[model samples]
Target: MKLALRKIRLVVHLLYGMWVVATRFARVTAQQRLELNRAWSLRFLQLAGMRLVVHNDGARIDEGALVVSNHISWIDIYVINAWRPTRFVSKAEVRKWPVVGWLAEQLGTVFLQREKRSDAKRIMHELSEHLVAGHVICVFPEGTTTDGRELLPFHANLFQAAVSASRPVQPVCIYYEDAHGNQSTAPSYIDEMSLGESLDTLLRGTPLTAHVYVCDALAPGAERRALAADAQVAIEGALDRLRPVGARVRQAAARGQAEQDAEVPHAGDTPAANGPLAQ
Candidate 1:
């Protein structure tokens, strides 16, 4: 909607969060901040009717780790943010979407104009700088959202950020479980749904349970792409194991399979919804 008006609310939230971050709960180190962030994320998910299933093998995801997850909906920001404060590397157009752009600014998210072919280089360069600086970054390697059933094929380019900065990239998967405890099969798309349409469609219905699974982190190196692929597989596998087999999940799998056949969003279909998400 109104971009100007949306920014105002973000400013308020930013100030409030900043106060809490800087004063009430002062942390000694970045790692400590991460711990606090995770606790907060857990609480956020609880309020959102979501649960986090983390399979952390004592793998400490300190300052130099990049979290890459499957894109599903705008809620991913809130889901991850509940766990930790992170910088998002997103499409440049997101900087104009009302309150979302303002929050991205406050959260130190970097936005690149994906509409231009050259923006990729700029994004990589920025990511390299941030990763080297020991900043925590979260990216959606799928580059787009899907029905919450299966992980889309990994976008290899986003994995390069961790390699460029010698940081580990972790894979995380998120899904929705309805009241009956059945997992949601699919979700809204930015290009396919606007903020109003999305909220209307989502809120009008009964709330669904959200699930976030954090898998073991991967090492960043020449095999970054391979790691990304493995992470996607791991998330999908974990999701499958957590929930029972359902027809929606099967259909979602088929949709992903068909996309691979046609090749989807090579680099420039990213749309701006309201924030650190797809259109």
Candidate 2:
């Protein structure tokens, strides 16, 4: 009964968000839009029974920076938004998603068409413009969701936007935990999981706390791949530090799974691996 009530509230809140996007988004200033996004995201997290705990080593770049993070679940987007609102780079198909898609478009999401190789260049150019305009652009370079035990390779293409705009790259690390402080994979949206299935899993779990660690920004170097590599390393180190004893065990198991998966050439591995838009 409690889970059902929470689900109802989430649906109503989602509807409210859609209404706000349809009505007020057109008239709001850029700063107002960011604030609105932040507020809605925080409320979404709260209603989902998740709390955000952010640890910043230093202040985030104010003038505009490319924010990169490991993709764990769709919830990762909101957790980051709850900390500091950022315009995200998502795949083009997300623009066609039901209510959420329309809201994402209105909320300043830049959609990338991943099918055509040329699209990456186009999206990169678009992202560069956003950064030049002093907008914080966040991308999950890992492209797809992971179980928070490890980070997949960071696609270096999008990192070029920051280099082109001469903006810094902010690497963020996120993981979830249950109320008792044990690492939780309850938020991971991996495998062939449906959105409804993922939500149901979360609704049935105990209250969760999302940890967002803001690592130091890397300078806009000459090479995007170099930047992406460095950012991935930074996030991996952060996640390692964030893990508990149980999580380490899970990580070792996950490593074995990764190795086995790598040996098999699956259809899921392709350019599209880096194309998913966030939740």
Candidate 3:
């Protein structure tokens, strides 16, 4: 019954979000839009029963930063927005994803068609312009979501926008954990999962805690591939630190050691009468 009510509230909240973006998004200033985006995202996470914990160890650049992150769940977009509302560079397919597509469009997401060279150039130009105008733009350079265990290689094409605009590339790492503090895959939106299925899984797995680590920024003007490589390394390191050592593995190792120790006779132990030497 509690879960049902939570799902109902989430639906209503999503509808309310659609209405706000449809009705009032056009009337608001850029700053107002960002604040509204952040507030709405924070509320959505709260209603979805997920808590966000942010660790900003790097220099804070409120604007003009090309924020890059490793993608895991669709929730990642809102997670970052809950911290600092920034425009996103998403795949063109996302621009057609029912209500989500509309929201992304109205909320200033720049969509890219990955296979088209012309579209790539156009979107890159647009991203550079946004960064140069002091707007924070974020991209999931991995091009797709993962299980949050490891980072895929980052695509270097988008990193060129930061270089062209001379803006710092801020790499943010995010992963989820359960109440027991073990790294959780509950929030992962990978595989052939539909949006409805993903939402159901997320809502069912309540009380997830999302960790966002904003690592030190890689400076601009570096080679794009090099920048992407460095960002991948940074995020990989962050994920390694975030995930705990598995209890099962530790237990297995301990049991194996004990079995090996038992096989060897101790200094005070006498050999068995039926042992090979006794014969």
Candidate 4:
């Protein structure tokens, strides 16, 4: 059974990856891209031996909005892609990663430098502009891969810019668990693994699962700091739903209020929420 599943997974990976590239050539509009994502992603999940629990409320994700989610395994990219027509905002260095990085660029991901404050400002400015023009940009607040179990404090800087953009902000939760429902402990990218080692690990006898919870979207005009804190709270809330055994509702409430009172000093009476509200 294990060998057969691994073989099936490899074939599906190739086919879906090809489909992603092929769709780009079709000059499909963003909506089309999103629709195709749902189909292809569901297929990938089935073949990869993953069961997906996507909690969405028909949230109307606005164009040019910023959606922040937690990062777990590299598969998070493909998994998220299945659900939306959003561009990923990742570290600039990811451009150098081998196969996956290549795909990210093809999908129009935005790259930002972490330590280069000035460059980061420029990237954020560009991101803001994109959102203004009506684009959905997705970012990982934790800034790195994790075991998909704990919440990482977010950097408020980027959230600040999203505030000025006046678009709805989304918080998404993600978790990857093994065959028996054990949260994956081997998927983090903290230590580099050779190509063969990684593939072998993925093909191991157990299949994993990915659960994504799309929480309420925040409206515009939140003060930068407040938005940052609120965003963290929203994401943590989504994660807690998946592991009710250790849910921390108070922690989420506190995180939600972190930067709220700060006020949107730079924001004028904002326009109506554009894409998806608290999507």
Candidate 5:
């Protein structure tokens, strides 16, 4: 019953939020739009029953910078937006999503079709233009969502834009945790789960807490692949440090189990302990 009420409230809030953006987005200056975006993003996070926690290692660059992060869930977009209203580079398919797509468009997301190799060069040019114009651009170089337990390889093509524009690259890391501060999969939009299904899971689960860690910015001038590698290493290191104790324990247990299984002989193979060669 409580979950149902929360869902109803969120639905109404989303409708009203969209109306607010549609009506006022045009009349505002770029800075004003950024402020509005952050405000709306915060409210959306509240409605979704999520709290954001940020840890900044250095000053956040507002202009002519590229922010890169690991993609974990759909909510990562909003979580970062709430912190700073930077334009995001998202997959083309998100542009077709109903209300969420409309909101993303309003928030100035650049949609790229991953299936087309040509899109990469076009997107790199677009991102370079945005950076040169002093707009902070955020991209999830992983190009997709993950379960929050590990980091995927980041696509290096986008970093070329930052390098070309000579913009500083900031690496941010996000993790979703439960009320007890343990890593939680409740917010992950993985596999065949639809947006509605992911939202329902979030609404029914415990309140989520997002941990956003801002690492040191990498200076420009290196090649794209080098920058991508450095950012990935920084983010992966952050994840290792900030990931919940429970998640770490589970990972360790899984490793131990795999090792134990490997030690056991196959049905047709002689056991290590009993084989004639064991002597």
Candidate 6:
């Protein structure tokens, strides 16, 4: 009964949120739009019975910063935006989603077609321009959502935008925890799970908490691949700190090996390179 009530509230909130975004977002200043986005994001999280807990180690997210994080679910976007309004680099398919798509467009998301090799350059250029305009651009370098158990290899392509614009890259780590404070799989938007299914799972489950850890920022001018590798290490380290005692020891050993592997380039590896934008 309570789950059903929450679902109904979520639907109503979505309707009202979309209306406000569609109407007032266009006329507002950048700062105003950011505040509106933050407000709606907070409400969205509340409707889903999720609490956002952010841990920043004194690292500031400056304007023209490239904020990169590990992806767990669709709600990851809102969880991050609830704290800091950023221009997200999302897949092109997100632009076709129903009400959510329209809201993302209004929030200034940069949509990219992943199947098209040429599209990367176009999106990179777009991101660079946004950074030049002093906007914080966020990207999920994992390129897809994970189950919140491990970190995926960060793709080096999009990091080039920060290099092109000479913007610092901030690494952020996110985890979903249950009422017991253990890592939760209830919120994982993994294989074959529709957005509706994910919503139902959360709505029926206990309130979940999102942990956002902001790590040190990598200075501009490093090659994109190196930057991506460094950011991955930072995020992996943060996740290690969040793990249970026994798990933390195992994860630390694995992470040390991974860091060493990242330092050794494969024979086919090349320096950061950006192709011309698709015409």
Question: In candidate 2, which residue ranges exceed 4 Å CA deviation?
Answer: 245-279
Backbone clash pairs in model 5 (N, Cα, C under 3 Å; residues 3+ apart or in different chains), count:
0
Which runs in model 3 stand beyond 4 Å of their true positions?
A: 1-4, 245-279
RMSD of 4: 13.2
**What is the C-alpha lDDT profile of model 5 across 162-187, one tens digit per residue?**
99999999999998888887888888
lDDT of 4 by residue, 1-279 (tens): 666667656666765666677667468776776676667667766666676767874774757678888876666776787766578888887789755677677777888877887887787788888888888888887777766667778877778658768888888888776776556655455457654565556556247777778878888888777877898888777776676442356556666777554443335644336523323
lDDT of 2 by residue, 40-123 (tens): 999999999999988874757766799999888878878988999888988798888777788788788998888889888889
Estimated TM-score for each candidate: 0.71, 0.86, 0.84, 0.76, 0.87, 0.87
Cα RMSD of all models vs. native, in order, equals 12.3, 10.6, 7.1, 13.2, 3.1, 11.0
lDDT of each residue in 180-247, candidate 6, tens digit only: 77788787788999998988886766588888899989999999999999999999988877766766
Model 6, TM vs. native: 0.87
lDDT of each: 0.68, 0.86, 0.87, 0.72, 0.87, 0.87
lDDT of 2: 0.86
What tens digits encode model 1's per-residue C-alpha lDDT throughout 219-241? 76656668777878877776766
Candidate 2, 113: how far from true, in Å? 1.9
Stretches of candidate 6 off by over 4 Å are 246-279
Point out the higher-scoring one by lDDT: 1 or 3.
3
